[model samples]
Target: MAALFLTLLLLSSAAQSAERTLVFAAASMKDAVEAMARAYRERTGNPVVVSVASSGALARQIEAGAPADLFIAANPDWMDYLEDRKLIDVESRTNIAGNTLVVVTGDGAIAPPVDPEPLLRSGRFAMGDPAHVPAGVYTAQALDQLGLWEDLRPMAAFGENVRVAMALAARGDVAFAIVYGSDAELSEDVAVAYIFPPETHAPIVYPAALTANAHEDARDFYAFLRAQAADGALGPYGFTKPAAGSGS
Candidate 1:
């Protein structure tokens, strides 16, 4: 009888110890979030399961009951979508990081252009699909500000996400791509051709929050992500700290 009791206790303990948090994050945040998840696991002995995709897709998945505990979006619109639907804990929403757009090209395949229009007009350039991808939306905003969106629309090759768009540039399928600055730093096959000025579009922000039905471990992990440890991990991956007063 004692042996049976001991076995059951051990099984229960193991089950409790195995609890993990599920995080849905934007594709662009893959590196930084994975690094932070590793650090969190080491520090707390709790595992974090990460799912990466475009913010729009992730949001729809969450809405369809994907069972994500936490969500990190590359832009506020997706977070707002959930918040408006009461799918996320509004009080927990906070902007955690910032990013900027850059033009990238296959290494040694194209020269950086001083005037972006000529290169964009000369050959197809890759961009995220502005209909849903935040990176593409930002790229569209910047191009519009430069008065190039309409004229260059016909030459644009749209990708489902920033990584897809960047890959097209890296593969030399397109002359250049507009993607997050952090993405350009990650690949040896690609090089930054130009950086859009900050004023060219709205500031890029990464907002993180717990889902409305998040478990205790999710809340703990969410707190850890808002602390200094996460901030340290993000910087190495080209993510900038959010400016003071940045909102979700």
Candidate 2:
């Protein structure tokens, strides 16, 4: 009888030790982060949960005391916001990857000029809400740089996020949509119109950090994400390594 009791206690302890849950990332990281989480679980035997949404929205949630263990934002701005508020562990914060902004058109549509100027003159464009989606903010920066923001403003359809912007373009509801290069690759219904010149806007940096509410196992998972082993895992999903001396 004592042996049975001891076995049960040991089993319970093991179960507790193995159990792990974390809000693993941002909406833009849906594809890559999901794959990484699955691989992480299989290799480490720890479960990770992901929350996908606009980086700004996720930041607001974390600030509101959401139980997030880790945050992977599509841009450094939101991560900076969290750090400013002391909601993230400073040592654990790092810019892990970069992405490009691309313009997309629905199936059968004529590709717009590689430069955004012609597209603004041609027809309406779809983009995420600049107030919340980093992709949209980047798009705005690019447009402003091209001196077409005023002209394009009249024809803009704002999506809640990049996915929605892609959807709008995919369904032929808009002439063009600005989104991440990864998003363009995922949707066969949409064709790439143009890739914004990297010089036109600020570099897009995806930063990850350990949240203050993270468990020990969650922190371990976050560290694993930055390891060299994870580099290739992030690339196929349209991420590039951070430039030298770029991340904070």
Candidate 3:
């Protein structure tokens, strides 16, 4: 009986060790990543833990000694940041998905060639803070290209992340918001006021990679996400799958 109990304890310990993996991803990746985690869990009987926030914040957290095994960044820049710090496994990095930037209105009708002066005079607009959030970075790029950044600068309400900016727009607390196209799909309360031209700013690409300290299981999960991108499983969540033969 004593021998059997010891064996059982060892088995439990191995199982626990096999189950440990931590994934840090962008806020925009919330629903889709959760669904992918569920599918992986069902298939492998191993659970994936996810922490969702701004890509920059997650990168900083990882740099600060956070135990993240995998990271999915909203853009290449944050991944580049981690790479520059030598925190990521260079060969494991891959382009997982893409997104579009748009302006959404919580209430009232607003359209293309958005006249920022009138809207700013009436109500505040929401944007993720350009300092560390990719959505805001894209928004700033687009607005500046459109020649509206200077006029609309002071009327913007900055949020910690893109989802929060979308929420503010959804609640009608902000007249409009700049967020991912996928975000507009999440909230019925808001509508796309305008789809910014892709050329207006740098392409919004989601790049993913494993941390240098990642466990073996993390490699499997990282591969799973890339396969999902290939399988088009992430399409419903508003992610653009890697094109065929693009070698994602």
Q: Which candidate comes out best when scored by lDDT?
A: 1
Per-residue lDDT of 1-248 in model 2, one digit per residue for the tens? Answer: 99999999999999888767676466778888778788889998888888788999999999998888899888889999999999999898888888888888885546556555766567888998999899989999999998988778888998878999889988888887899988876677888878899888888888888987778888778777778324566887777776556667
Q: Deviation in angstroms for 133 in model 2?
A: 0.9
Scored against the true structure, residue 176 in model 2 reaches a CA lDDT of 79
Give candidate 3's error at residue 243 in angstroms: 8.5
The superposed Cα distance between candidate 2 and the true structure at residue 20, in angstroms, equals: 2.5
Query: Model 3, stretches more than 4 Å misplaced?
Result: 108-122, 242-248
| Candidate 2 pairs with clashing backbones | none
Ranking by TM-score: 1, 2, 3
At residue 139, what lDDT does model 1 achieve? 93
* Candidate 2 TM-score over all chains jointly: 0.92
Every model's TM-score: 0.93, 0.92, 0.91
lDDT of 1: 0.88
After superposition, the stretches of candidate 2 with alpha carbons farther than 4 Å from their true spots are: 1-8, 108-114, 228-230
- Please, what is the whole-model Cα lDDT of each candidate in the order they appear? 0.88, 0.83, 0.87
Q: Is candidate 1 or candidate 3 better by TM-score?
A: 1
Clashes of each: 0, 0, 0
